[model samples]
Target: MRWALVLALTAAYPLIVYFSLGHVEPRYLALLLLVLGGLRWLAGGAQVVQARWVALAALLLAASTALLNTSVPLKLYPVLVNAVLLIVFGLSLVRGPSAAERIARLQEPDLDARGVAYTRRVTQAWCGFFVLNGGIALVTALWASEEAWALYNGLISYVLIGTLMGGEWLLRRHLRARHARLQA
Candidate 1:
């Protein structure tokens, strides 16, 4: 499936860049960026409004990657992405709708006051995660070995995100069930 292929490419991208450095032609990095961006843009056509930011990020990545020297830029892409995420989440906490609220509304437009508060907390959690992840990514790009960078950014970061997401889902489910029982 398309999602499967996208995930495979995403999971493999850092490893490819890390290992291919000095082993393969630099032009290949540009090619890979184009491919990834094109794929995201195409897939983004059907996405919801809040999620459209991802499409924009993909386009930016492709354009910037094409223009920059691949040597360091390729390694720094994840750092750039995490920084963007940190900003987006941090901004949401200030004045506008929380990122978690936007995402929750996608599924529950009439979510209750409790739900809104809960989503805000979830947003805070995500902001914290982004800060931590972005910090590690910054360190990786600046000082870590290639293998360390690739391993943390490529594998560990994804796992941590999944764990956070899964934990949130489980907690939300438990809260929802408890509320339903109370109402009954």
Candidate 2:
């Protein structure tokens, strides 16, 4: 139930900001975010190091927003999310097993050298995407109007993510078929 509420709030974040802009004070919104951070921290988020860091970041952002009494920090949440993702994906590339390889191994435990290479390339692609996306997100947060910011972060970003995933799936399928033909 707590997870559900958290997820709902997180998903509705853009809309919440968009609607609340005029009527609600930014500090109150920051308080809500602080509540969310508290909930996450209390909900076993600390067990996972990544989640703990995310929760801490959220708490910090909320605190900053409260202190500044500005909506800028609230607007920065998407930028923060993208930065975290970029770090995670970028680190996986530097570390032993890339994140794409890790996820691929879940279904194909006997992943070959070729598969390893492919996943590594995919991870690199994702890192690039994150860098681009994060840059745009930051631009929107800082300079764009609230409506524009919400439009990109809330809607367009999801579409771009879906498009990337779909394109990858299609490419993977084609590569698998080509490999099978070569083997035959």
Candidate 3:
């Protein structure tokens, strides 16, 4: 329940900022984000390297927003999220058992060498995705209008993420079927 609330709040953050802008002060929004960050950090987000870095970045953004009394910091949240994700996924490629491999293991504990390689490639693809997504996010935050920022961060980005995940799932299914036929 706690994690669900946190996730929901985080997902709705862009819209929240967009709607609240001009009506509510940016500092108050920053306070809300700071509280959310604290909740996530306390709720075991700090246990993982990726989650911890994301939480820390969010906290820093919130603090900057509060101090500067500007919406720029608040808008930079999505950019930071993409950056943190990129770093985490990219690092996993350098280390053993890439992020996708770790996730694949949850479903298939006895992943073969082929599976490991596939997951590693998937992890690399995610790194590429993060780079492109993060660049767009940075552009939206810096020069785009508030509506454009909200539209991309709130709607378009999620659609793109879903598309990537769905595409990957389809490809994995096809590969699995081909491997099964070959083995048979």
Best by TM-score: 3
User: What does candidate 1's lDDT look like per residue over 143-178, in tens digits?
Assistant: 888889899988899999999999999999999899
On lDDT, the stronger of 1 and 3 is 3
Candidate 2 residues lying further than 4 Å off, grouped into runs, are 1-8, 42-47
Q: How far in Å is the alpha carbon of 117 misplaced in model 3?
A: 0.4
Pick by lDDT: 2 or 3, better one: 3
Q: How well does each candidate superpose onto the true structure, as a TM-score? A: 0.76, 0.91, 0.94
Which residue pairs in candidate 2 have backbone atoms (N, alpha carbon, C) closer than 3 angstroms, thus clashing?
none
Best by lDDT: 3
- How much lDDT does each candidate structure score? 0.75, 0.84, 0.88
Q: What's the residue-level lDDT of 146 in candidate 2? A: 93
lDDT of 2 by residue, 93-171 (tens): 8985998999899999999999999999999999888888889988988999999989988888889989999999999
lDDT of 3 by residue, 1-184 (tens): 7678877887899999999999998988998778777767766543365666677888999999999899999999888878988888888899777999999999999999999999999999999999998899899999999999999999999999999999999999999999899999
Candidate 3, clashing residue pairs? none
